[model samples]
Target: MSFIRPEVRAMFLRWREALVGAAILLLGLYWSFGVTPGLLSWVGYLALIIGAILLFAGVQRGRARMGGGGPGVVQIVERRIGYFGPLNGGLVDLEAVTSISLDPTEHPRHWIITHEGGPALHVPINAEGADVLFDAFSSLPGLSPGRVASTLKHEGTAPIVLWRRPDLEKRIARLH
Candidate 1:
């Protein structure tokens, strides 16, 4: 039994990080501007810095959620990426992925994972439990998790390869 409405609660969950960031930023700004000229000012400055960091991180996280629009949840466990969506869901081994790319043309950008002789795995960026992918994807050679995450928000019209296995990379290099 709860007083909160379901839709309102869902919206809160969706933007919780950004909301927290906004709260922190507001507190910092209030303290920095409202307080007297003393040691508290220094504290206010620290808070401001922390708040700014949170705001930036939170905004990015919110964007991730917005971009990851999909029916199912995404989970990363033991280096396997699992999707439990309404119409489709499956698991893929991170270690077995030969190439990773960001398909920016999609509505909520998708992280495309390709493996030898297997259909590409499409993982929505905002899928629940997708955050865990940072570490899992970081383990792939030549892949930068930070770069991958940063690109997730970009609404590019073309697909960008985040990482490629040495064989594929060399083949492409040779073609040039």
Candidate 2:
């Protein structure tokens, strides 16, 4: 029933970027310790090396996404901030969703947002049954109507807001 598939390829963009950055930094540090004697120069070199690697990876990945080779969905279910369920077929806690908005398109469109201290994910839903899907998300208990807004303006173009992130820290605090 879900469109988004669970795959390494589907890992969030920010996660990928962070992972790549960490990898580059670690590699640079290791290399620096081996070849450099000056601490300041070593740190500088390490930064330069890490930056270059991350930059290269970002560009390549961007090109891939633009080319339509991005990860295809398996089962895409929106989740609230504190919880991460199985992708596609999982339930999201309404309290964690700070906002929900519909993405605008040339045709009908729907998207969900989750606040994760990053840009909102503009998930594209199947247009045919979008109304039903929208209803489903909207009807979730505790969902705030004010959070869901149409991205479209008078200009006749825009992306839809799907869901926004609520305060995740509070959720975690409650759980713990």
Candidate 3:
């Protein structure tokens, strides 16, 4: 039920800072030549500084986007995973994925996947920020909402432990 993803949190913070700074700067400008001129001027300067910092952060994010490392493609498959020994709860099929995108405003860090006839899953992973969790999950292979759902019985919950197959990990390591 969480609307905002973790990755987007940083962007929100930056925006809030920018707005507050702008308001303070406006107020300072209004009272520049009025009572307590020195104090008002200092307040205005502080506001400007805060606003500039926020704006700079936002601009830096924009630059990352321009660099063109787009989010990976997600294809949704409706297959379920059952117990299989050590990997009973860890194996995930690649055929199951819906859509994937990297819009920081929405879901950050984790990819939000909605199964055809199942619950919506959010797979958390390392990302530029919490809001970009989607990018991190989508970037990796064999990890989709349904795949995660198959292993984890919880939805919209935290600390979902994933037990990837050691063989697969070894193969990945070899490739790397």
Candidate 4:
């Protein structure tokens, strides 16, 4: 007996974080510009800053999430990512990850997580629990949420390298 339609509900759930951030941003804006001076105004300024950061992060997270229902399950535990797909599966340690790439040529697109001394683990963009990869990928050094989101939205046929370990880049440069 739900009043909301399924599609609307799904959309809301997908952008829940951004929606909450927007609410906070609006509240902060009202407080900062509305009457009531003194300490309350200072608090409003603080809220403004926090709200802005949350809003930015939320938007990135929202963009990174490609709806689920793909063929697999992703799990992150103790700084390791495990993907169990119908045909193939593998584990990738966060610390050992040397590069992250996106293969949009595939039917559902795939995130190619390459690690040191191991075959790259290909996880579909819409795999179950894949949304959590946003947080995992963000934890990598020098990887920005905005860049991840942009890479996810890339329309290229060839795989795009989203991130590469700085140390690895230097080593490769030395070899070349």
| Cα RMSDs, all models | 4.4, 16.6, 15.7, 1.4
**lDDT of all predictions, in order shown?**
0.73, 0.45, 0.41, 0.91
Instruction: Give candidate 3's whole-model lDDT.
Output: 0.41
Candidate 1 lDDT, 25-47, residue by residue in tens? 77877777898778777777787
Local accuracy of candidate 2 as per-residue lDDT tens digits, 1-176? 65766664555542465466666766666666656577755785767677677755554333223112222232324533221222332234444455666555533243555543455444444322232333345465554333332222222465544343446446867999
Q: Compose the digit string of candidate 3's lDDT tens values, residues 1-176.
A: 77898668645553553455556556655555454767767776665666666554443333233211233322223443211222111223333434332223333234344334454454332222332332234344654533332332234444333433335558779998
lDDT score for candidate 2 against the true structure: 0.45
Query: Comparing candidate 2 with candidate 4, which one achieves the higher lDDT?
Result: 4
lDDT at position 57, candidate 4: 80
Candidate 4 per-residue lDDT, tens place, 88-133, comes to: 9999889999999999999899999999887899999999999999
- Distance from true location, Cα of 153 in model 1, Å: 7.0
Name the runs in model 2 displaced over 4 angstroms.
1-71, 74-93, 106-110, 116-118, 127-132, 141-155, 159-176
Candidate with maximal TM-score: 4
Candidate 1, poorest ten consecutive residues by summed lDDT: 60-69
Model 2, position 107: C-alpha lDDT score: 36
The TM-score, computed over Cα atoms with residue i paired to residue i, of candidate 4 is 0.93
Residue 152 lDDT (model 4)? 86
**Whole-model lDDT, candidate 4?**
0.91
